[model samples]
Target chain A: EAAVTQSPRNKVTVTGGNVTLSCRQTNSHNYMYWYRQDTGHGLRLIHYSYGAGNLQIGDVPDGYKATRTTQEDFFLLLELASPSQTSLYFCASSDAGLANTGQLYFGEGSKLTVL
Target chain B: GDQVEQSPSALSLHEGTGSALRCNFTTTMRAVQWFRKNSRGSLINLFYLASGTKENGRLKSAFDSKERYSTLHIRDAQLEDSGTYFCAAATGGYKVVFGSGTRLLVSP
Candidate 1:
């Protein structure tokens, strides 16, 4: 089984505040993703990386910046955070990319509250 | 934009009863995954299908890329089955779009 860990299980920040959510996967998967879950919306992709130093914009990338420093580490940065960005964040990793790669192993979500 | 339309925004089933959840794709998807948001607020992967059907325990899932749809069937529901279920479809060559989710409540 793939193991994905996330830091700061819970966070609270104010508008314009800066917040960073970190994710680390020991699975050495080549694909990593950042997602946010909101009510009425299951999980929306924010950013993803196919490999180290590769970042791709997702369906909902506004107010979010992500970095894949290494194959095992991915970070989601919320610069100038806003109330609309408050949501449960999840990180995932997959050993494959493109087709047949949706079999993602996810980390426990991080709850972020923006005031 | 790729969109996934999931039906039955909410479902109610009694223990030992069964029901099905469906997701319809606006565009052809390469694959689909089903997950359950557990009580502890963690997503548990249930099934990942590129095509055809797969069955595990009391759950079964099928994905048809050409038909642009997928279905998840839960039989003999248990209390542990009560949770939010989501379907995510891989579209284009890059991203995956998720459904609005279905909240399932299983009672005695």
Candidate 2:
């Protein structure tokens, strides 16, 4: 089975704080994505990477940045966290090819609370 | 932007009952994926369909790229099947658009 692990399962930070969420996938997939889940909006993509050192913007990329340092590791950074940024974040990986087109392996998720 | 609209936003079914969730895409989708978000905030992938239908256990899903729609059917619903279900559509450009999600509650 594919394994995607995330760090800091839960976090509480004040406004203007810097927060970094990390994710690692053992499946060796070529695509990695960062998404946030809100009440009415559901899950909105924040950023995605096709491979190491590749970044693509998603629907909701404001106030957020992501880095894919390696094929297996991806990071989501909140430089200046705000109350609106409080939400459950998920990291996922996929092969993104014909062999595994829409099959995504997702991490447990990281919940961040900004006060 | 690609849009995937899913409904009904919330559903309640008794144990042993069944229902179906639907997603309508604004543009043509190359593929569709179904996922259930457990209470622990873990997303469990249920099915991925490029076209036609696929089934596993009491769950079945179908994607019709020509019609720009998809459906997920749950038969003999159980308590453990209750969760927030989401459908995502991939429409080229390596972009996958997600629906607002349907909250399913199965009560005994």
Candidate 3:
């Protein structure tokens, strides 16, 4: 089974503070993604990585930066945390590209609160 | 622009009842996926269809690429099935666009 894990399940930070959320996947998937979920909105992709050092921008990449240091680890960085950035963050992984057989396995999610 | 639109922003169903959820796509999609988010915020993958219909357990899902829509039918709904269900579509690339989601409440 594909396993994805996230660190700092719950985080609280003051405005302008720097925050980092970490994710690790044991499936050795080639693709990793970061998304944020709001109350009435669907999950919005913030950033994605194709491999250990390749990153791609997603729909909502502003105020967020991502780094894939290893095949198993992906990180989301918020340089200046704002209240608008407060949301439930999820990390997902897929075996390869987006194909019919490629299903995304998500982490439990990290709840970040910016005060 | 929203690439995916889901119907019945919210739904309430009694236990053992059946209901269906729909998702309309803005453009042709290569594949569609269905997911159920539990109360604990875990997203469980229900189905991933490139085309045609797929049945598993009491759930059935269909994806029509030409019509740009998909449907998920729940049979004999159970209380444990209460959660937010989302439909996502993968268009021409590796990125998948997700619908706003439908909040389902299965009451006894």
Candidate 4:
């Protein structure tokens, strides 16, 4: 099984504040993703990276920025945060190939509150 | 519009009973993955199906790409099984969509 860890299990910030959520995976997977879960919305992808120095926009990439410093590290940055950005954020890693059938290993999630 | 729709948004079951959760995709998905969110809010991977069925302990999952649907069956429910179950589908090589999730409450 792959191991994924997230920092700052909980966070609180005021509107227009800056926040960053970090994730590290030990599996050396090439694909990393950032998603936010909210009531009635399930999980919405914010950003993803195929490898270091590579990035891709996802379903809900607005108000978010991400960087894949290395294969094991991915960061999601929320600049000028708003109340709508308050939710549970999760980071995941996958090793899917051309078929894209691989399962994702997820972190424990980080809860952020915007005041 | 590509979407994953899950049924029975919430469910309650008694210990020793069983139930099934279903996810239907609006478009052709390459694969489907099932996850369970534990009490502490950690999402645990349950199963990943590309075409057929797979079982682990009291949990079983099946994916029928032709029908654009997948099913997760839980047998002999236990208190530890109470949480939210989410199904996500992989499509267009890189796009993954998640369902609204089904919250299960197992009571003694």
Candidate 5:
């Protein structure tokens, strides 16, 4: 089965603190994505990478930065955390194609609390 | 502008009953995916449809590219089936836009 794992399943941080959430996938997929889920709203994309060393901004990328150090690892970084940034983060991976023939395999998600 | 809209916002079903969840897309979508989020905050992929309908176990989903919509039908509703269901549409791009989600509650 395709596996995507995220570290620090839960975290609590105070305002202005720096936070980093890590994600690793064993599926060797070419595409990886980071999303934040909030109540009453759909999952909003934060960042995505097509391959190692290639990072792309998504819809809601204002307060977030991402790094794709290796094919298996994608990390989301929050330089200065704020209470509004608290959310459940999910990591997903997909095959080569854009979505025509590929399906996204998601991780268990990391719950972050910014106080 | 929202690309996807799912309805109804919330639903309640009795055991042994069944219903359908629909998603409407504002633009042309290349494909659609359905997911069910468990109470533990894990999202389980229920269906991925490029076009037409696909069924597994007691769940069925259909995607109509021409109409820009998708639907998920649940049969023999059970307590375990209660959760938030979301439909995401791929707009021929790298990103997939998701709906607001449907919160379902099934009681005995």
Candidate 6:
């Protein structure tokens, strides 16, 4: 099974605070994604990376930014956090390229609270 | 606009009963995936299908890209089967969209 580990399983911050969430996948998958799960919205993609130094915008990328520093590392940053940005974030990795696609393996999730 | 619409938002079944969850897509999708959120809050991949059907144990899933839909059938529901199920569809570019999810409760 593929392993994707996330740091700071839980976090709390005040408005305008800076927050960074970290994710590392050991499987060397070429694709990594960040998604947020809210009550009525379900899971919406925030950002994705095809490889190191490559980032793609997702549907809900308003208050967040992401970077892929290495093939195994992906990070999400919130520069001026607001209460509405508080959500459950998940990191997933896959080796999807063309016809050869794989299932997404997700991290345990990080719950953030902005007051 | 939401690309994937999954129903019934909630489900209840007896231990030996069965049911099916369906997802309707507004446009053609390249592939579909089903996942169950386990008690530990991990999203467990149940099935991934570009087309046709795949069965594992008492659970089976089918995807019809041309028809713009997918179905997940669960037979002989067990207590452990109770969880929130989500269906996601991808239309290439590695962008996957998820449905609202169905919460299933199996009781004895």
For model 2, the superposed segments whose C-alpha errors exceed 4 Å read: A97-102
- The list of candidate 4 runs beyond 4 A from truth reads A97-99
Prediction 2 TM-score vs. true: 0.96
Candidate scoring better on DockQ of 1 and 3: 1
- Could you estimate the TM-score for every candidate? 0.95, 0.96, 0.96, 0.96, 0.97, 0.94
**Candidate 4 lDDT, tens digit per residue, B1-108?**
689999889999999999999999998888888999998889999988888999999999999998999999999999999999999887757678899999999999
Tell me how many clashing residue pairs each candidate has.
Answer: 0, 0, 0, 0, 0, 0
Which residues of candidate 5, in runs, are more than 4 Å off?
none
DockQ of each: 0.65, 0.53, 0.64, 0.62, 0.66, 0.53
For residues A5-112, what per-residue lDDT tens digits would candidate 4 score against the true structure? 999899999999999999999998999999999877679989999999999999899999999999999999998999999999999988863246667889999999
Clashing pairs in 6: none
Candidate topping DockQ: 5
Residue B54 CA displacement from its true place in model 3, Å: 1.3
* Model 4 Cα shift for residue B95 (angstroms): 0.8
Give lDDT: candidate 4, residue A98. Answer: 20
Per-model interface RMSD values are 1.7, 2.6, 1.5, 2.1, 1.5, 2.3
Error of 5 at A50 (Å): 0.3
Whichever of 4 and 6 has more lDDT, that candidate is 4
lDDT of 1: 0.92
Residue-wise lDDT of candidate 5 within A4-110, one digit each (tens)?
Answer: 99988999999999999999999889999999999888889999999999999999999999999999999999999999999999999998433567798889999
**Span of 10 residues, lowest total lDDT, candidate 4 chain B:** B88-97
lDDT of 3 by residue, A1-115 (tens): 7899999999999999999999999988999999999988999999999899999999999999999999999999999999999999999999855555577889999999999
lDDT of 6 by residue, B18-102 (tens): 9999999998888888999877677888998989999999999999989999999999999999988999888776778899999
Binned by DockQ into CAPRI classes (incorrect, acceptable, medium, high), candidate 5 is medium
In model 4, the Cα lDDT at residue B1 comes to: 62
Report the C-alpha lDDT of model 6 over A9-109, residue by residue, as the tens digit: 99999999999999999999999999998765568999999999999999999999999999999999999999999988999999983224667889988
